[model samples]
Target: MRVKSPESLIAESGADLEGHGLKRTMGLFQLVCFGVGAIVGTGIFVGLSDTVAEAGPAVLVSFVLAGITCVFTAFSFAELGGAIPVSGSSYSFAYATLGERVAFLVGWCLLLEYGVSVSAVAVGWSQYLNELLDSLFGWQLPAALSAGPSDGGVVNLPAVVVLLMAATLLVRGVRESARATTAMAVLKIGILVAFCAIAFTAFQDHNLTPFLANGVGGVTSGASLAFFSYIGFDAITTAGEEVRDPRRNIPIAIMICIGVVTLLYCAVAVAAIGALGADAVGDKPAALSLVVDDVTHSTVGGGIIAFGAVVAIASVVLAVMYGQTRILMSMSRDGLIPRVFERVSPKTSTPVRGTWIVAVVFAVPAAFSSLDAVVNLTTIGTLAIMVAVNVSVVALRRSHPGLKRSFRVPLYPLSPVLGVAFCLYLIWGTGWTTWVQFAVFLAVGVLVYGVYGRKNSRLGATPRTGAAAEAARGA
Candidate 1:
């Protein structure tokens, strides 16, 4: 029951990074690209249609609201990431300020968030890939193979394939993965900019006449959905140990990621609505492609947008899978999970085994399950994690006022307070079914901690025995 103190956690994280040989290859630009790569994915590509359905043309306001909420939490992430500069992101921050138990919970929630997120994004990728095939070749895979059970398909083979591809990339090494992600990010952003530019040409005032058709309630609901789009910004914080000059670069990268992605989301939302009206955008999975086709009156335009989506969702899978493996590595280093997860490959400097395991674990669901079922779960888990991180920042600041921080939240207690408040507000919008599911997930986490993690935790064991044993094995 011995709680690991902040100083001990910080020291241990440094030791883990050094002991495992994670390469510090990412500079500020790469880090920003990673953040952007993670943030600007399926949410805008596919979820935009859902947001419009909920909020009508007022989805533009929804994006702004969601972005503001994420901004508040991103500040908390930036401050803590700068101060801690560890790979676990919120999990490490919680262990420092809260305790081993709460840290385990945060790590568990992150597993749910990152894992489900990768799977959901993979499913989205499959949809766009199918669309691309149809548009470019006049053929698509049979529905039985291309869709999940909920969509009347036997399995989503494309989703599983994309997940495996991303897993292969991750095992190659962080530097290699970063390079690929950056290229994909640049390509996708370019396509999105092109989409907005062309879509605006067909913009009509009549399309926006009933902007508030769904009312304020719908806007709030849309914001909650849009919040998922912004979930990946904190994925950058998970790279703290691998980022050069983390204390400065982490915060800078987070802010830059948030700003760029938010603007892009708003612009896209406006362009889609202005071009085709709310009814056309709502409930359409390939709404962006539809807008492109309508604007240019050619299948080629839609095919191009679909191709961009394939690249965009693939990048999301890569970044999110990377985040999941790192979080598991951090947890395993603390003995909260199996030590296998912490094994960094000597040749690649990556968690090869863990990446494969994560890919398999999520791939099954992505193949047979529905996206809507899992996407909301990710949003709920992420919102909960954000609240915990905000609380952790407030506690750490009050307890350790003398700690050096390269980045500070702009408004002190107010910032974190609002961050938590906004998260709670969004949680309220997730509905009671999601709340029940979240409660069930937390209960399972508690059981696992009580059964295994609590007793085996490195922080609770004698240093000479626990960490020493692990180090001797070169884990």
Candidate 2:
């Protein structure tokens, strides 16, 4: 297997972006909005309940732990993204520093990360939509049509519908999608602020008395789950090809997105626990909406929170679906996947076919599968990807010492080392079942790479011997 050099990858990516008709219209603020939109969705609205169950009121500490780990990884991403602004995000960085084989595996893991995440978020949106409808109109979708088999329903029609809608928005254009995402992000943040205000009114000091009811181990476990909320900010890196002045914009946007979302997540966690208590929040599907109702003593408050959740999850589906298609497009261009996925529509300047393909694949599982299992799979895949990215930074620093990096990771190897260690620590907390599932997924990825990717890789077409070959081998 031939390794694609960093210089080669960057040149090819520039040509691919133009040849594939992807527009470079996203600015720093818009990119930051995309990250915020993706990062602050289902994780806060739905996953918080699961975190609360794991660590009780101490879920706040879980949020902090997850945020710190993500911050370290984010710095690595910013540095690499600035140096090699491409659509594949970590996959591209890995290709430049690791090898085609490693890059292919990274891309496969991302398929699981972004693809399944979109589906999971869509499912969460369906639940919140049902809550909103029932609150405002006094009627809900029939369970047979609204939920998956695991949730005692035949098909999650709402989930499928939301996925299709998000795909449609993406097929239109990135600018339009960014605008929509920004609007939704503002709306959701506003709702969260309102929720905090109301919840504080009902805050009971005793609710936080047994904050560490589940112990330090529980807080660590909760952080493992909370890590899911931090997953989507990296999706912004996937938009490297679409952003203007990517070198400067990518790093700035990543830091801003992480900082803003971490603050919001911590505040929301505190308010929710303070108002309704962790026990009440635990196991509830739409915990934010429940907290709103309990705090304000009105169905109207719940309805508002439910509506915010509907918009929040939609933004997540949009950003994640966009990231998935772009990653596939990058892979397809490198001949790792079928070329059909690389085709871009002249009219829309978007990969319409690949977008729909992802939509169908995402929608089906979401229509019939359970959320917890899929979420667990997504978190593990993401952790693996994060580890690869952090390592890529360390490797690139040594291999390409003179490369013009617009942003450098602070503290050099220390940042990336901590990033890897933190990611592995969270992975350990994910338990045996998640590890088994991740191993199975990677096994399938290896089979695919051996059977198809290695044979078809564009890089392997060129021969590199002597020092260049040695460099490729080192990479």
Candidate 3:
């Protein structure tokens, strides 16, 4: 139950003089690209069809509301990330303000969010890979080789292949990873712009007649689903120790990433709807490609879109996998997990072993099992962690009134309170099955903490050492 002090956390973050810690090489541009790389992935690329079906042409409004919902929690993240600036992201933030047990549980939740997200993205990546390959080569991988067990296949080979490829890039070094990710981020953004330009060329005013097909209720529900599209932006905080001047850059990157993603999302929604009537876009997979195919009437335009999806999704896996390694590294440093997770390579200045370990752990599931159900855990876990972060802001404000926060959550209690409320509402929207699954996951986390984390926690060990030193002096 011991809470780490902010001073010690900050001290450890700066003691990175040599190869002992993550190298501080990323600036605001890299940070923003890192975030955009993670955020603009398969979700927006392929899942827009369902969202559009729910909200009609008004999916644009859904995207805006979803972005607004994320802003509430983003404010809290900006505040604490600026103040603490640790590699652990919210897990470290929770440790200093919420206590070790809470921190462990939060870390456990992050493991679900990042770990499962990678696998889920991999599964989706396989679909796009098949699309791009079929477009270019007139052939696709066999169903048995490309599908998971649930989908009636031996293993998802392409999924495993992509995950390993991402792992390979990550172990190289954060700078190398950053450059690759930044280039991909820019390329993907250009692709989206190209998509908008093409879709707009065929704009039909009559297709957008009933913008609000089902009124406010449909937009609300669509926003609930679209909210998940913005999940990867908070990943910016995971690079805290690795970012150059994090306090200034982290907040700026987050806000900028969110704004850019939101605008792109809205623009794409409008373009797709303007090109094809809302009814035509109803629940088709890869809706962007569908819009382009309808207008250009050729497999070539759709093929280009598929290629964009390929790069977009791959960038997501690379960036999000990076976040997962850093989160585990933070937990390992606190002695809440195995020390192997924290060991960074002196040569590369990255957690090579841990990065590969994470990739292997998630890659197996991506290959053998379908993530249709398990993926829901990520939504529940992400919401739960965001709730803790929102509450941590209030608790930290009260606990250490004088702490230096470069950016404070504006509107104080109301802002974070709304953040908590929105997150809990989304959690409930996931339904009882997900709640039960998350409950089971939490029980397992508690068992792990009791058996290992509590006994080995560095914070819990501190007082014992202090008391032993005092007793020796007395004797």
Candidate 4:
């Protein structure tokens, strides 16, 4: 049986948004807040210590390197978002420019990028919870209860709680969720700025010596971890349906968010290395609280920093989880996934069913798996999706030369080529295991499409009449 084209599914999927109660009321500022909310967490809170351990003082340069790579990818995303102006980001772009099969693959990869990202963030939340506990009660949760097996714990209850809570907020609605995220994003950024200011006062020039202690390999590894901080800026483009004038606003919002977040990451890198020295910063546990303690010579500052990290991790959980639900909504609408996943609540204008399903999937790893496993999987997934996006931008430009693009990539083909190169370099730094796992995961996605998605896709199933097919081709 011929299936309907994805264009038809896209037409069908958003019917609820046009009715009485299911309206998306988001604008550019709120969308920008969502991007920043997701961008500022985890990578800075927990990954900083690990990056320092990897590169020593040279981690500062690693941040710069990673920032450049992200900026390049952001350009690709901006162009695609403007051209497609769809809710699924790369998934929608692929469907229109590539094919339904390739679109299915992109959607599956996004499930990993956003879903596992939330699980990975929950793991970071567990650490901050322990930090706050240690400071306030002079007691900490047992490692088995607070961490994953890789980190010496058997289960992670705190992580699960964080995921569940964020899911509950998402179920409420996007506006409510964005409001909460915006508040937390501000708090997290404020706390980071405060830490940098205090830490800079205690800087010692001698700590800068032996900056390359671990050599170029270590700096590349550190850059790999720091690269995580920049992934969430593209989250803004995912909200195309809700944005006012998406073609104009999305590119601007992405560039703004990327530039702002990059500066913040660099400042934290410089301050942490200066005050505590690379060795001491690397030696301490992977918690922001330790950085505060080293700078202030008091436990109080550590407590405040821990509080900020908790809020920071919470915002990441909310923003990334929201991204996951919205993308699934897009896929559901396309018929590559079950239609149930796209069901929206009449009162809330949110996909309640998809929200619960994503919550359960994320809750497992957040509750029981190791943070390292989640991070590795997320890094691999994110790298794959970004590379796909860069390639998609070039593919679309070639396939549809006359299509109107409100925001053009400044240097044309060269910009996207550079984007792809940078993404490939970051993937190389992730090591062999990530590569093997990513390949296996991608094969599974292909299998899913072969078995079900290809047949059920609105694109392949819907047979357009001659005039309709021509119209679609023209579009």
Candidate 5:
């Protein structure tokens, strides 16, 4: 149970993780866009239908609940991201406070979060692309090209293309990627706002009647699904190394992104419900666009929203994949995985090799895997990681009480404790099948760690406890 020291991680922070180090081109604005970019995609554009299917109009409340749940864990992430400011994010936090083994497992779980989540967002992008095409020209790609096997298609070519597009942007450099994300984030927000405005004009009280269409059980289930929409806020922490003045910027950016996104999501839910009624909004793909179509009685209006969704989900693919690459880059530096992933392209200062590998690996599944499976897996995995992050905050507080923290959890232990409880409560709402999937993923992670990770881990060469204590005291 030897842990890496937080002081050491902070001291060794930049450039050394990967040769040439990542370029710190991101400021507060770009960093906030990164979080909004990763989070604002997919979940609201396409998955809103599914969440509404579960919770009805009460899905609006579900957004608030999920946001509150994430707020608790986010307080912990803000504290650690500021104090540590590394690319490994929760994985690095766990290594500093928990131990090597826990770090490995936490990183493994992160793959399910960022990696699978990117794939899910890509698939959502494909659906929106189809929506846009049909709206503009009354035509779309054939099912064989546009859909996955389960959806009665040979392949989801659009999903693969969008994933690669994001990978290419990421490979070029972080600044370019951040610029693209920021522009897209602004565009998508405008589109959603516009949709809300139009839908409000036609708001009908009857549409929102019987708000709890499915009852309390449905609202709980919907909150679990809505949780996916807020999934990417933690991604702000993933860019710790790439952001300027990370200590102050990371926490501020995370809070701003969540506040903006939550307000927007709740507004969108209310507008869509009021405009189209619960039944119309639920179980319908491209649900927002459909509502605009109904309210305006024009396909062109829907087409505009569809176009925005395409851009929105594409940004998620770009942003989330960036986060995934950095996570692996951090893990590789620790020798928990091959060093190839750790190698930075000196020219671009990006993990080019790992970025492509992540895109290709996730692309295959996005082409054929079911969206529900990927979304559920990502949600559960993220919840587990949040639990670890909250615990790490508590552990680090006790382990290094003198550690300088720019921000601290407001209520001490109670906030993190509640964070854990809220996460577990949501997990309880998830189906047993998702739990089984997570267990299997964990078992595989353990096997990989026991085999290659344990032997090659950088810490294996050091007397961990003594060195860790010295490093802690050095702070």
Candidate 6:
């Protein structure tokens, strides 16, 4: 067998075995829709209940604080994304500037962030599913039939169903998938607007009397929960290869999506709490569903909210699944993970294998795990990834001076620094248990690298290696 030249090895290292099919088809509008679809999901539907429970009337402040933190990180993400128009989003960017080890960590973190995010959305879907069922039939699914472990249910059938449905849609292609997501996004936002409008009519100023009832601790917890809503902002970056003029549009879409979603969240939260009162919001036996019903005094109104919740959770699953597959595709192409995940179908221009892998990975958890458990794990992963993103932006600017960036972080070091600080603060608030879990997860990733990723990595695999040698010998 002949040993291939070093140049051949490096060239093959960058090769995309799956054949990336995304050829800049999305425009500003489509990118915005993608971000909106990913961002406006369960955070508003089920998360509000969690936030109110944690912060009481002070949850409003939590939303604002979380929004501010998001603004800072959004700038960092926009800058890095615009600077590097790659399909893997931050993972690719880190690989180019921060080296392979750092890139691997980013990819690992994203696995948890996107994976748990999809499952969390599915779990949220189960709640609305039961609610919708009861509203129409005047009967509800038994606890054993619906809900998750944390929510006092045995199985989460609806959550699994949503994941499989999303997986199917994602395996089809980007254009059709985006269209489905856009439709769902419209419906979900429309329902929220309608819910807010109706609830506002019954608002009582006195309901907001103890606005700071839960104090700083409650507000911080609310902000942490609220951060889940903003995860969609990064989803835009995952579609970099599919966006038209990614350098110009990615940043705009991210910021615009954040602004739009923030406004919608504040409006709905204000309305829900004001009409029902913070105590009422927190005390409801069914929480969110009960709040909607209390404000409207009609089962039909609760049903509308339920319908919206279903759409919101479904959209989140779809968008997060799409993001996860794309990241895995990029990782596989880069030789960080197994190559099979990078294989895109020639006929469909989709990562069928990758999509299936993501679906199965998340669906099992959706079927069996508790919501809060997965959500906290996801939150820690997301915050860690955001910190990486902020650092990556600063490092890239200093290290890659010649690289042209279409959108630059407005304040350069300040923006990135503040972004890192905010993310770190949130991570700190997640408590010591989350940190320990994150450490264990990272350790597992390290072992995977030692056992497989290091040897198989496209980065480390020279053409003279066994696999390439065998191929050349066969040829």
TM-scores, all candidates, are 0.96, 0.98, 0.94, 0.94, 0.97, 0.92
Q: Give one digit per residue, the lDDT tens place, for model 1 in 322-378.
A: 999999998998888999999888889898999999999999999998778877788
Compose the digit string of candidate 5's lDDT tens values, residues 1-475.
5567776676656656554878789999889888899899889999999999999989988889899999999999999999899999999999998888989999999998899888888888999999999999999999899888888899999999999888899999998999999999999999999999999999999998798889988988999999999998988998988899998999898888888999999999999999888898886978999999988999999999999999999998888898888889888888899998998899998889999999899999899976876888889999999999999999889878998888889998999999999999888778899999899999999999999999998867666456566753543
Which model is ahead, 1 or 5, in terms of TM-score? 5
Model 3 Cα lDDT, one tens digit per residue, 1-475 = 5777777787876654234777799999999999999999877886687678778888888898778768999999999999888888899889877878899999999987799888988887888888888878989999899988798888999999999999999999999999999999999999999999999999999888787997877786677667767878989999999999999899889889989999999998889889987777766767788788889998798899999999999999999999999899888888889989888888898888999999999998899876454556787888899999998999889877898888989999999999999888777666688789999999999999999999998766775457444432332
Which residue runs does candidate 5 get wrong by more than 4 Å?
463-475
Cα-based lDDT at residue 220, candidate 5: 86
Considering only N, C-alpha and C atoms within 3 Å, which residue pairs clash in candidate 4?
2-461, 3-460, 3-461, 3-462, 4-458, 4-459, 4-461, 4-462, 5-458, 5-459
Better of 2 and 6 by lDDT: 2
Between candidates 4 and 6, the one scoring higher on TM-score is 4
Model 4 lDDT-worst window of ten = 1-10
TM-score computed on alpha carbons, candidate 1: 0.96
Evaluated with TM-score, which candidate comes out highest? Answer: 2
Runs of candidate 6 exceeding 4 Å displacement? 1-15, 284-288, 462-475
Which residue runs of candidate 1 sit more than 4 Å off their true CA positions? 1-3, 17-19, 463-475
lDDT of 1: 0.89
**Candidate 3 local distance difference test against the native:** 0.86
Clashing pairs in 2: none
Error of 5 at 173 (Å): 0.9
lDDT of 6 by residue, 193-240 (tens): 888888889889998878888888888877888888777689999987
What are the lDDT scores of the predictions, listed in order?
0.89, 0.90, 0.86, 0.80, 0.89, 0.79
Error of 1 at 237 (Å): 0.7
Candidate 3 residue spans exceeding 4 A from truth: 16-19, 212-217, 464-475
- RMSDs, each prediction? 3.9, 1.3, 3.5, 2.6, 1.9, 5.4
Local lDDT at 277 for model 6: 84
Residue 370, candidate 1: Cα error in Å is 1.3
